[model samples]
Target: MSDRQTPLLGPDVFARRQERLRQELITRKLDLFIAAPSTNFQYFAGYNPGRSERLIAVFVPAKGGSVIVCPSFEVERLTRNAAVQDIRGWEEQEDPWRLVRTALGEMKPQHGRAELALEHTFDYASYLRLAGVGGDWHIQTAQPVSERLRIIKYPEEIALIRQAIAITEASIAATFAALQVGMTEREVAGRLSEEMRSRGAPGGGLVQFGPSSALPHGGPGGPKLAREMVVLIDAGSPVEGYASDITRTIWWGDAPSEEFKRVFNTVHDAQTAAMQFGKPFTTRCQEMDRTARKVIADAGYGLFFTHRLGHGMGMDGHEVPYLVEGNETRLEPGMVFTVEPGIYQIGKFGVRIEDDCLMTETGLEVLSHRVAKL
Candidate 1:
């Protein structure tokens, strides 16, 4: 069982979030920001009413308070949990889009400035209805506004992430200790999942053994674990809506081959170099990617080092402020992300070392220290 404590978010937190979103709307020149049934909606509404063919939305107007429009059956659940006072519901036969239109019209948005921003997860069919009802109001993606607020970690969120990481590490350690040679990749993955769930994790993640590790996202049913073969386990779990992601590659039974040792060391060094370069307010997000990529490229494994160096982590396993090429977003204090550099050789083996890190005033702080040594 995990000894780490999970932090709780109260109504005040949601209130502050709504206020911040309202401020962002004004600053970004958006008239109405709409979040459907997704993380963005949960971030403000304090609950996820789930997604469906029916329309469920939260409208945050720039000049006034927010409102939630859901099916009549869900109104009571939302009312109990959501911070927003305005709750509008529609019955089975009624058109929910009309309710959304009524809510938007009530906002009294000026025609020329009636710009609507919808979350990326908003369904396309609903978008059509909302767009038609919105008349001449401009429609755009709300990712910028919502991602801006979610990329930075609050203290409570960090606490949950820490607990998730601890639980994930403990489960991985247990799984590794119980692993036996000749076990199938699926068997090992099942054991890992059971261990993680037992340790209070919501679920487990990827597990690849032997040559299957060569595929970055290798499917199950690959070769069995054997002596001197590489084993890669990339797993995580949720702690109170927050998430933890980590990847560790290890040799199975006996000592690894010289080539395996060299590749592992190179990948490890790349991850270290990237983390060291991730300073707040100074380093661009892509710099971390470049730093790690350069290390692998210099080691003559450039082509093998496919995919981005890492990605941001939070309520969702992967989010904004991605550590990849062409992302110019500057790192800031309270920003958290992963630093994972890997090399994949088809029909051979792969090595990946991933860890979570938080950007602080002084520098970057690594959050997961369980599998630092290969």
Candidate 2:
């Protein structure tokens, strides 16, 4: 169907990832890291069984091998692709929390006063169960440790993300070419979805038009496309487990008003400024946001730019190293993220341009570049 190549990550990559995570755990002074069924677990284990009422987790001890705990029926399925060898299965009637505790006890015999970091996705009930397992253990969020590891991309990971971006760009181009003045927002979104899926994307994302485009993260079912309306399409595709997120806004027909051109140019200039400012070892994450915000603010459209400048993009569309106020994480080589600056005027129109960028040893490398012109 699709001409794109799907690269496979070998066992060596998984081994290295585990080693890095274990090292990070030690550095963070955490004894054990527990991950529920989430992107973090999939990142390590290479298997993504959807989350459910039943408990499924990967337990990584600071000193030793990782283990997965899941339902009995899923043991075989999980083992087929998961890199971790030790998988403990719980019967439907058994309490999985006890099994998890047993596994942790085996991994660390001196469990008393142990420090454990739980992935953020764990449900409250699961958290309480695991918290009750050992009375003296310290429990905290695993975000710091996990986010640190996932924020940096491996070469193979970047390749997958690139493939996804390529597919997404093609899909958006097709949607734009096929769009008509009378087409509904839903119809345009459907066309975008068709193009993406036809190109082997797992799914399609958002497409908004006209006044609805003024709302960030707007849904479909809005008014039909009209002449001189702003069209905004924010969509992405997943390649392997990595993701590609991009957004582009355009005027449907004829030249837009001078005000619209000014806003567009301001947003474009803001994105350019952010990209120019993003450099490895030098640019703090929030600095990118500030640089972009300054451009819009100076142009007198500061209040219209409603959201943060950007966010980290990888396995999850939005992740660590967020480009927003209060985040002081410095950019580093191998880190990938989005630099999207927008101007949304409620009841009127919106304009946003996003590009996925990789922080390289030299500087920022823009990954999604097909739709650069506004």
Candidate 3:
């Protein structure tokens, strides 16, 4: 989205997010909570950050008003953007513990009442430091509330995701069409990234090609694009902070050997099967992962199907609701993630098919167009 259009959440919008969080907190018996970063803070405080370290502590009392503890500099912004009743600040010189102590002083929660739900954002070291203000206020850290909330998409969130997916879909299409023998894998990735940015996508990406595809995350480098090798271009676009993740493995040159074609078709069919069955409320996320692997396995490439079938992608590229084995997280409607099935034989070559899927009210929808071209 453009700079003019902000994250769809406004002050009152944040209040709704907090209402849900407060209910969760109350259920968990948390009297006060300190959350941080773009999504969580934005969810509760309606505040977004251009950079990190802008700490925001949102304290929702079980019985009374909620307060946002912030650095002195951000108090004004928080006041304007937040639906909170009180704005607490600490001077840059003074230890933030002054405000932290004040907020904690009031919340005589049962035991873990005054706690912090730190997402991937909080460093363990920082949590250790907060241990300094130790007292009856059991200042503890837990997984962020917002991360769990963002796993499900709201209407506006789905819109941004659709735009991100469109841009990504177009970018991949262009990349496939632009492919030609003798161009480097780096070149193909560059073409796609520039196109995404030009089409209003956040530029730059994680892409790899050739035998390097064996490395799921081998980003751009000076590797030559060759014939008879699969070009694995995994890229995406972002809109209003929502991101889409997609990958396409386009093989160039003449038709492959009997073994390679059989494997490629099997993977293609595996990707299709995985998508056909992905839907809300399925315990089959791991089953979906296994579906792809089983196909590759029956064809004798099971070991090569590295990495999970997908991961949650919304405000952040990777979020919750991961589609992997050993994970029993139920897939739900409004959930968005990738269904990327691949076979990577290290050092020789790799082939992967990735696409974005949205678990809709009806069933699974391919948000990112899953088309192979090269």
Model 3: residues >4 Å from true position, as ranges? 1-5, 50-56, 60-66, 76-86, 110-120, 180-182, 254-260, 372-374
lDDT of each: 0.86, 0.86, 0.71
TM-score quality measure for candidate 2: 0.95
Model 2 bad stretches (over 4 Å): 1-7, 109-112, 370-374
For model 2, how does the per-residue alpha-carbon lDDT over 1-374 read when each residue is reduced to its tens digit?
12222238877788888888889988987888888877888787776777888888998888888899999998987778687899989999988878877876776636356888889999998888888885667899999898989999989999999999999999998999998878987788888889988998775877888889899988988788888888899989898878999998888789887877888888999999899888899899889999999999999999999999999988888998799999899999999999999999999888989999999999999998835444
lDDT of 3: 0.71
Q: Going through the candidates in order, what is the number of backbone clashes in each?
A: 0, 0, 0
Q: Can you write out model 1's per-residue Cα lDDT over 189-217, one digit (the tens) per residue? A: 88988987898767787889878899889
**The 10-residue segment with the lowest total lDDT in model 3:** 1-10
Of the candidates numbered 1 and 3, which has the greater TM-score value? Answer: 1
Decreasing TM-score order of the candidates: 1, 2, 3
lDDT of 3 by residue, 258-305 (tens): 655666687788888888877678646787787777888888888888
